[model samples]
Target: MALFRTSIRVFHSSTRKMTTSSVTRAPFLLSPNQVSELTNSGHTHSVSLLDSTWFMPNSPRNAKDEFLSKRIRGAQFLDLDEVASSHELGLKHMMPDSQTFARACEKLGISPSTHVIIYDSHGVFSSPRALFMFRSFGHENSSIIDGGLPRWVDEGHPLDTAAPILPEPGTYGLPNLKEGAIKNYDDIVANSQHDPATNGHVELVLDARPKGRYTGTDPEPRPGLSSGHIPHSYSLTFNLFLQKHKTKTGQEYSTFLPPSEIKAALDNAVGTAEANQIINGQRPVVTSCGSGMTAGVLWLGLQLLGVKQVGLYDESWTGYSMRPTSQIQKTS
Candidate 1:
């Protein structure tokens, strides 16, 4: 049996309204201006601003060092690697157990009622993963800053270099894991065997890695891992969901493409018919990437397109490829 049942809805972004401390904003996303306004109004106590920056292992940038040097005023750093579960497979950013997650939240001064606004140093890169973590832990009162810290700086928002003050530990309790929010390796294997043409409820696995990696023409960044895709999975690079835009000061940054453009990209990736099936909830979606970080981008993109029946393969390709019995498809 699949870990996630067909009836489970992963995230309901539409029709869900969330209030950010003193300001009521749309659920799941907030603009930089709105975040600044909330902080300026002295409602920071009711909300937690988390800088959830991360980079690939090959990247020279250290997210924590960058955050320490300069970060949004009143923002606390949430290390994705540190706050995650110590996976037996050595997967990075695996969702921690409920007790562990609750403790991390408490240390960050996050109560059950506190609204979390997550952002990354890179615009819209890893913040969605952070948002997913919170939501998976049943913290639905969280949202991501629309364009992250780069956009904030592009808009002339000031950064604070001062050391962050430790937050008083909040009285947080163990949270229930959201049922069906994650898909495991067995689930993927089962999903792969289901023929979507015959099974309308079949879950679609969308790969968020680059096409080169998906086709097995390029080497995986991680050593010893085979480069290929999950059977029947569609390659939809995470960057397709984002677009580059120049700010007023001539600084260019990346942000989510508009809904129309995102939908078009989806159509291109999975074909119009399959995309429609996903959007209309006839076929559920489980997004996967090399290590599951970029997969959150696809998860968020589907939410933006109003696809409610979606989940993330938490261990993603990393876990899948490591399984000796796993089947990998390569086009090239």
Candidate 2:
């Protein structure tokens, strides 16, 4: 009943001007008073993350025992079993095409107005890919459930075994371009050279790739790519932040180190690099890794810490390697 009212309010409010923040945040986060007001004004629809599918079984799931024996309410399972393609695009499970995104959304009853939140069994890799798809489409307020469903189940949330029912997908009311909050490949290179404060809001350029890759000691994931880290990018591989012991009193939640702990780790890395930037500089941080994939894990972590200007370098190494003449500093 409350959701239905909110949906009506959103429709009415759409007749007036809409701010970027209004569309980008989950609907429930909006004040209840504000939501009621929108409903009173006659908005037609409101969207929430509860509508999207959650893919909890990705590459880095816990040992079979630690896996999600229980589930979250309203979640639908999406397996990575033999990768399928949409139409004849001929892509793989790892790199889904735009058409594949549209079809998947349809299969799950996601319209342009539906707020979709994605998460996977793997900590970072698969969820970022789904987040990228939400950005590609015009859906607003799309986010990956950080730390995936394992965290949710560990905390003893309600589980729903019965699968959700879906109505036919409606026509997409997607915007032409600005509909999604995504940065392009070229934009990444241009921003790498820009001053984050003066030119734009840039969070730190943290690299979530392995130290070997960041220091030029390893080959890249994609074929025919030069091996090295991006200039001025700091390394913070996905493995380091994830604590292994859920039972230990000191460290739990596998990922998301408390800020005090993260501060010390960042300080050590910054000192090693000889960069004297503030230990807790309040810059919005962007993360990069091979082909712009792993970096999403870091961005999601920073977002958990309440940093507002988080983003991913969509092209990442793919863009850096393409540069004709670029610097490749091998940090000690």
* Leading candidate by lDDT: 1
Tell me the number of clashing residue pairs for each predicted model: 0, 17
Q: After superposition, how far is residue 102 of candidate 1 from its true place, in Å?
A: 0.6
Worst 10 residues of 1 by lDDT: 1-10
> Could you say which candidate leads in TM-score?
1
Estimate TM-scores for all models.
Answer: 0.90, 0.57
- Candidate 1 Cα errors over 4 Å, as ranges: 1-26, 246-252
Residue 321 lDDT in candidate 1: 92
lDDT of 2 by residue, 1-332 (tens): 22332223232221333333334444212322332243344432333223122232343444222323434444444432221333221223333445655566566556765655555544335565555445544454565554455455454444555545444565543244222234545555655675443543443577777888788778666566677766556787866544443522332434345545555565555442222233233454566776555665565554444444555665566566666765565765
Question: Tens-digit lDDT track for model 1 on 71-162?
Answer: 99888899989988887788888878888889999999988868788999778889999988887777766888878887998888899999
Candidate 1 has what TM-score? 0.90
